[model samples]
Target: MSEQRTHSPQEPQRRPRITHNRKKTRRSKAAAALLYVLFVVGLSAVLATVGWIWANDLLALNKDYTSVIVKVENDESFGEVVNDLKKNGLIEYKFLFHLYGWFSNADDKIAPGTYELNTDMDYRALVTNMSASSSTRQTIDITIPEGYTIDQTFALLEEQGVTTVEKLQDMSANWNYKFTWLKDLPLGDYHRLEGYLFPDTYTFYLGEDAKYVINKMLVNFESKMGDYMDQFTEESQYSLHDIITIASLIEKETDGEDYGTIASVIYNRLENTGAETQGYLQIDATLVYLNGGKVPTEEDKAIDSPYNTYLYKGLPAGPISNPGMKAITAALKPENTNYYYYVLNPETNKHEFTRTYAQHQALVEKYGTANEEG
Candidate 1:
C-alpha cells in the first residue's frame, strides 16, 4: 500500500552504449564492400578502354588517321584481312579490331570494296569504314604503252624497279586465268595478258602485287568496253576476242590517237576487193613484233610465226600490245573511209592517208622508196 501511494511516472531507459570495437568493425566491413565495388568498376572501365591506342605511337601522332579506311570488298574473311594488315604493318592490334567489330555487330557485315583508311582512326571510324559498301583504294599512275606486249610490260615493271619478269611469269604459270572470250580463241588461249592490259595512267602503290595490277587493268578494260563487246561481235560477226585482236592490231599500227583512221582502214581493207584470205593484213608492225620489236629488214619478212601478219593472213596469235581506250573505241566503231595504204611522214611521225594504191605508190616514190629506207 505504501509503494502504490507514490505512483511516479516511469522514464524511458537509455539505449545501451555501442562498443568501440563493434563500431570499428561495422565501418571496416562497409569500407571493404565499397572498395570492392570501386575496384570492379575500375577494372570494367579499363577493359572497355582496351585497343584505344596503337602500338606505333609515331604513326598515330603524325596523321589524322581518321575517315579514310581501307575497306576490302572481296569475299575474303576478317581473319584473313587481319592477318594481312598485321603483315602490312597497318594494324597494331588484331584482337582489339575483332573486339571492336564484334561489339559493334559489324563482324559479318563488312562491305566488299577497297577503302583508304587514314591512321589514328578510332573504334567508330574503323567500323564505319569497314561497313561501307564500297571504297576507293590508293592508286599509282602506271602507264602501259600503246603496243606493249606482256613481256614488254614485265620489262617495264623491271625498269621501274617494281618487279621482275620472272616473278610475273611464275605467277602466270602458277595459275591459269580463263576468261569468257578465251574459249573462242583458236587454241583456247585468249585470257593470259592478251587484251586486258589496258593502256592508261593507273594509280598503284609501292607494295602492289602483280595481281593488283592485273585487276586494275581488267577493271579499266571492262569500264571501257561496257556493252560494246557483244555489239561488236554481232555487227562484225567476230568474237569479243576478235574485236580485241583487231584493237590490238590498231594499237600496234600507231602509238597514239592517229590510229583511229588506221583502225577504219583495216576494216575497209577487209571489205575490199584485194582481200587475201580474210584480207592479208600485211601489217609491218607484225613483222616488227616478230623481229623482237626491231625494225624488220626485207629479209626478216621470210621468218615464219603465227604473229607475223605479213606472212599469215589473219589476226595475230594474240594482242601485240596494250591499247588505250581511244584505240578500243576506234576498234568498236571504225571509220567509214577506205584508204588502203598509209605512210608516216618521217618529219611529223604521222601517216599520209591515200585511198588509191597509185597515190600511195607516188607518195612512196616522193618519200624515197618502197622499203622505207629510213
Candidate 2:
C-alpha cells in the first residue's frame, strides 16, 4: 500500500546489467593486451639469441691460439679435413666451415700435406691456406752448437742436407744484409760473420736456400741481442766486432762460469800499464786458432799471424768462433780487477788468478802447466 506507484515489477534493473557487461568487456581487453606484450618480448629475445649464435659461428670471435700442424691425407674428404680442424681446436663451427668450403670450391682444392695453421686466422684464411699449393714443406731440425766456427757450421749444415759449404761461403761473401752492425765489418772471407750467427736449434725447410738459412741465424742473433744492443753501444769502449772477438776467446778458454773473470784477465793483459805484461794478450786460444784446432806447440806461439795474441797486441783480425750470449755479455762487462794472469788447473778445470808474474809462476808450478789436458 505504501508503494502504490510500483506498477509492474520495475524494469528489471537495466542500468546495472548494462554497467556489468561493460566492466567484463574491459577486463577481457586488458588480458589480451598483456598477452600480446608478453609474446612480443619473447619473440624479440629469441631473435637476439639467434643473431648472436649466427655471428659467433661465422666470425672468428675470441680466437686465441698458437700455431698447429694438421696433416691431411690424400684420401681424406673435405668433411674429414674440417673434422680434423675442429678436433685440433683450429675452428669453432664444423658445419659452417664445411659450408664455406663447399661454397668457395675450396673443398676439392685442398692439398694433401701437413699444413702449419694458426687459430687467429678466420675461416676464409684457413680454407685458402689449405687449398694453396705451397701449403706444406718438409722441415729438418738442425742444432748449431755454441763456439762453432763458420766452417764448422757449414759442415753441420752439409751433414743435415741443408746446403753445401760452397753455397754458404758464397752467400756469406756476397749477400748484403741490412743489419746496421754488418755495415762496417772488415772485408774478408766468409769468416767475417763468424761470431754474428747465433747458436741455437733451428727448423729449416729441406732444400731451403742458403741465404734464407743464414738469414734466420742472423735474425735470431739480432733478436737475442734485443735490449743489450743499446747498452753495448753506449757502455763499452770496444766496438761490437772487438767485443765478439774477445768473447770468442773467452768461450774457448774456459767453461761458462768464469767468463766475467776471464774477460777481466784479457782486458788486464791488453790494458796493463806495467812494463812486463803491457799490451800482450797471451791467450792460448788464439794460438790454437792459428794452428787450426791443433795443440799449440812452442813454435806455434811464435808464429807472426795477426791472430797470434802472444805475438801481436790488441784483438785478433776477427772473431775466432761464434760465441753464445753468456760469453758476449762477459766481454761487454768484465769484472774490475788488477789480476792479469790466469792459469787453468787441470784437476779442477778452473783457473787460478795472479796479479804478479811471480805469483803466476808459483801457481803454474803448483797447478801444473796451463796447457794440461782436461
> Which candidate's TM-score is highest?
2
Q: Assess each prediction's global lDDT (C-alpha) against the native.
A: 0.65, 0.79
Runs with alpha carbons beyond 4 Å of true place in candidate 1: 1-140, 173-179, 183-191, 232-236, 255-257, 273-278, 370-374
Each prediction's number of clashing residue pairs: 18, 0
Q: Indicate which candidate wins on lDDT.
A: 2
- TM-score for each model: 0.58, 0.62
What is the Å distance of residue 174 in model 1 from its true position? 4.9
Cα lDDT of model 1 by residue, 1-374, tens digit = 55556668999899987799899999999999999999999987786554234434323444433443353534468787666555544556788667666776766665544556656654455456555442333334667876677778777765664445666555544544455644343432333566677777766543345555566677677777787756744466766766777888887776465667888778776666463234667787778777788877778878888877667766777667777777777887787776777776766767787876677778788776643411
- How far is 336's C-alpha from truth in model 2 (Å)? 1.7
Tens digit per residue, CA lDDT, model 2, 268-373: 8777756368788878878888888887888997898999887888888888889998998898889998778877777777777888888888887887674432
